[model samples]
Target: MSEHHELILTCPKGLESLLAEEAGGLGLEDVREHTAAIVGHAALEVAYRMCLWSRLANRVLLVIGRFPVTDAESLYAQVHAVDWREHLEVAGTLAVEFSGRGSGIDNTHFGALKVKDAIVDRLRDAGGLRPGIDKLNPDLRVHLRLDRGQAVLSLDLSGHSLHQRGYRLQQGVAPLKENLAAAILLRAGWPRIAAEGGALADPMCGVGTFLVEAGMMAADMAPNLRREHWGFSGWLGHVPALWNRLLAEAQERAAIGLARPPLWLRGYEADPRLVQPARNNIERAGLSSWVRVYQGELATFEPHPDRNQRGLVICNPPYGERLGDEASLLYLYQHLGERLRQVCLGWEAGVFTGAPELGKRMGLRSHKQYAFWNGALPCKLLLFKVDAGQFVTGERQPVARDTGQATPARLSEGGQMFANRLRKNLKQLSKWSVREGVGCYRLYDADMPEYALAIDIYQDWVHVQEYAAPRTIDPAKAQTRLLDALAAIPLALEVMPEKVVVKRRERQSGKRQYERQGSEGHFLEVREGGARLLVNLTDYLDTGLFLDHRPMRRRIQREASGKRFLNLFCYTATVTVHAALGGARQTTSVDLSKTYLDWARRNLALNGYSERQSLVQADVMEWLEKDSGEYDLIFIDPPTFSNSKRMEGVFDVQRDHVRLIDLAMARLAAGGTLYFSNNFRRFALDCRLLERYTAEEISAATIDEDFRRNERIHRTWRLQAGKTR
Candidate 1:
């Protein structure tokens, strides 16, 4: 074993090159990459040093023996022959972890059991005492691997998986493991990007894992900067001085980075729930000031305000396996592609998804395609290059309906009739808003004129209003007329060529943010089922609160009483006042935007209940890390898109919803219920993802009177603690 004199380090697959570079940087010699290992010949201290400073590797393994084995008995015999006394005391506790591929040893558990028996038996026979098994915390950790009749035994220098970087005080759903995140950064050649001052962005960043990992990589900060302990620290051969020196050296290198925002780094998630956790992770990684997490819809992500072109945007959007259907995922991808081509010019893009078919929807040719494993699922990292100059930013062309024998002119005639009606309605709306003290007005004519499309933005209820037209008509003509009038409006508002969302007009088309503003504030009111609601007419194309969740708000008024309430991503605080009036003991509202959070406070005061509510102007995800307060009633309604100047970056609802839901459930009081809603029309809830909590679909209860044309406006859900797995 001593004569072999070579060190083989185990890293999460695909990070071998990074580990090799780290070893070389530490002055180790003969660095080479293997499938999941980095092999090099170095002094024993180099192995010890790697355990302290190498952030990309999972463990620094001190290889004890490598031999061929065909059976458990042979493996046991070989394991027994090792000098156990050198690594573990007779009375010490030891744990064995085994991984095998192909070969005769098919069961990893059985292999582990055999190795444990051999180690204990050999030690007992030699010293009259056997080491104890300590699975949770052990004095010695041994890793055994059998690959196609070849066996390797090594001491696990870093225990508990180096991915536990010790900085994660909290997390959201399917969080990228630290090691995995590091591998992703390494794969992206982050060091090279950072060196060039290239920007890093995660449009669907969850808990800021990717952003934090990228920041650490760019700054050359050790991945274990926050780690308090390592498995190697307990080894009999551990050198405390060397470990301390490595850590100090890494810290000194980080200090030289100046703590400046790398060329650029940002993350966006539509769900406000992830905004807080992502901020928490970034801060934990000492990247709070360097990385930003924004809570808003992807459609609203405008990287450049005046100039429409900008930097790279990367995302790890959810594959249907753990989230929802491929069809919905495809829509998200198509929408993302449309946005990317329109807004992000002269930029590069990378999308990691398990579903390859979905990648085709992006309509961009792959510059590079990499195979990666997100846990057990094989995923593809498809890279695309976008031309900022040639990007097309416009609404999607409507799909022709299979209306048999409908003449082309027949369709055009219907469209023209609808356009004329819309022109008339807009004229009336313009006159009414001017006369009725309104700024914007809703027009029944939009992408489809045969539909009841109400436009509003007249009054203060841009805070919460809806455009409700009492008549139902064909949607195609309405949509065309709506866009025509929008094009004709003399508003001086900035319209991002890439931010326009065009759809076939589903009965439930509330996915993207459709907001437009006129120099004048105008809104339209649609009365139906005895409810008259005003819609945002000027500041945005659509009103803020989807009017469909009106029932859920009413439910809050019906059920809230003497309970503490929490509203995450509290846009206009419509639900905050609802809970407060329902008699909540105290309400804490969270959102990234001070503008919206302040609006929520005003809404509460407007309803005569100000003393009972508190507004927190921070990312809810980050705030949850330091917040342990539980609430009896919680409302988590996040935006479809927002680019808050106060936040880190942008957000996408479909990508961040699962984790957001889980975290909200974590803070619920015993017997507490949380109302989580989203307007992403194509959103499909992953029941398996929320197996730890019981969820009931309250979509029916959330729909209000004015929003009956589309039933899926908002989804209300109740969660309780339970074992999902």
Candidate 2:
């Protein structure tokens, strides 16, 4: 027991390198990255520093034991062999967490229970007292990670997940975890850039996680400064004087580095609600003095006033999965291009997105695209060089639409009949909404038959939404059906230069055409919906809008009765038209870019509601802070990411979701509902923080055909009545 000395510190999966870096920075020798663990050898001070400074680690583990265990009995034997009295006292509460794969110990819960029982039984047999289990707040947390036949046990130094940086008192929709945010920064080369006067930004800086993380990095501030509980506090070897000395040294390092501020660490968001939360989060991180938060739209944001410094802009934009249509996201990216070219000169920009088709719309030539996992979904972090003179013009060569034959797949007569039924229902819904003055109609024609597609008909534009499985065999077949569904609407497919967005499951051999242009505006016309507004279905794949929000559109149709409606970050004004037709007295749409406002107006005119609507090309939050307009109904669906130049900085939906909802609720009428939605897959509503308002999750109500019943589009809820202090 005394001779064997090997410890492995486990962290989040992708952050192995960061933990290794932390270990090395703290003077720990022989640090190496293994799967999800950082293997290192260090004295107690090195562990203390790692606990104090690492921004991307969940917990700093002091590896105490590693042994081979084929079953639960062996696990117990190995755990009991270590003298429990050396560390944990009989009176101390302890918890065990197990994570692993492929072993007889298949169940994590059972494994954890077995370990706990072993520890307690050993302590009781030796010391004659059994420590109680404290699930919510434990005295010590023991982590066990099993790989193959080996079991590695370590003492967790950092309590809870390190990503739960105390800075975030508030959260937004599907906000990026702090550790993940830090990992992204490290991946983008932010530390070196910050040292060299490079600006760091998140256009959609939801709750300002990226910006705050960047600021903390720039200021050399520890991510765990505000956290009080660390597993080390419960350890017998914890040294108070040494900890104080380490903290004082860290503070001194920050002070020494504070002589000159890093260049432009900023965030920009369109939702007015995000502004205060961003401010609060940045302030909590001790980055208020180092970082700047602007409540503005990304589309029209201008470059920083200081012309000498070139900046690095990073955006995590909405991928049309949760918020709105994919076509409108393209519009958002179109303005993004305009802003990037006009303002971000000699700068490097990186966009982290789970959607590849959406990235193409940015119109910038990507220099490098890295495959990464944003949770379980495979995403790409695309890096681009913003050359103002060279790639300023958003130019693209149009390819001809493929008239080539598709491989035959058996679509039986019964399958075709079911598809026809779905198409008919879609046509019926479209006609009813158009005739009833609803500008946006959620048509379910594509949903009932089997293809995971949602069809929405906007007077002039048709949105086709598609969901492909995790592994797709034939992407062309999927794309073809998507195009065929769009063509079934009778709108001649006029493929935009950057329109065809292909998401390939795996790399395929041979040539593949991704885009086409100058296609005929005429197509096979079919009137399935009640409205006779010419159904111009094209032969190309989806280009109009995303269709998952069909239920949300229906909700808008139901709720827009005799109310004044305001749409924040309004892309193409689909909801605006719905509200207008629902008897909304006046509709005001606010976005940062004039381009989107233009598209919004076009969408409104397509539905014949242009005269009743007003478009304001300004940051919605800034406009709300300045303007005193009250609305009966307000729809706040912000982009997942936006880093615009006309505005001061970037914005994030997850970090800013709660605050945006609060702000919208503040401006809402006495009995109005602020319908706030974001497409963040893991969006968690901070219900406790918003106790002043009544909120109910409407994620179920927002689902459509393109999104399977189990697939959630955006987590939504209705907020009414302000909280009473």
Pick the lDDT winner: 2
TM of each candidate vs. truth: 0.52, 0.59
- Give the per-residue lDDT digits (tens) of candidate 1, residues 1-725: 35324677777666667678877886568788898788877776676666656776777777789988978889989999987877777888899999985456788898999999999987895447778898877888999888889998988877777778877877877776777777666665666767776777787887888788788877777777777766776677766787777778878888876465555788889888889977887887887667888997866665544453345577888775421132245446666776666566666777877876656556466667777777677887787777633323333233224611111111133434554564665565556545534333333423342333443333322121223333554444343443333322212112222222222222323322432333334334533222233333334434444445556766876778999988887776776667777778898888776645655665565566667588888877668767889999888877665554455656567777777777777888998887778776778877665667777777876653334445665666766677443
- In angstroms, give how far residue 702 of model 1 lies from its true place: 36
- Give lDDT tens digits, candidate 2, residues 463-487: 4546553354476555445433432
- RMSD, each candidate, Å? 18.5, 20.5
lDDT of each: 0.65, 0.67
lDDT score for residue 204 of model 2:
78
Shift of residue 243 alpha carbon in model 1, Å: 1.4
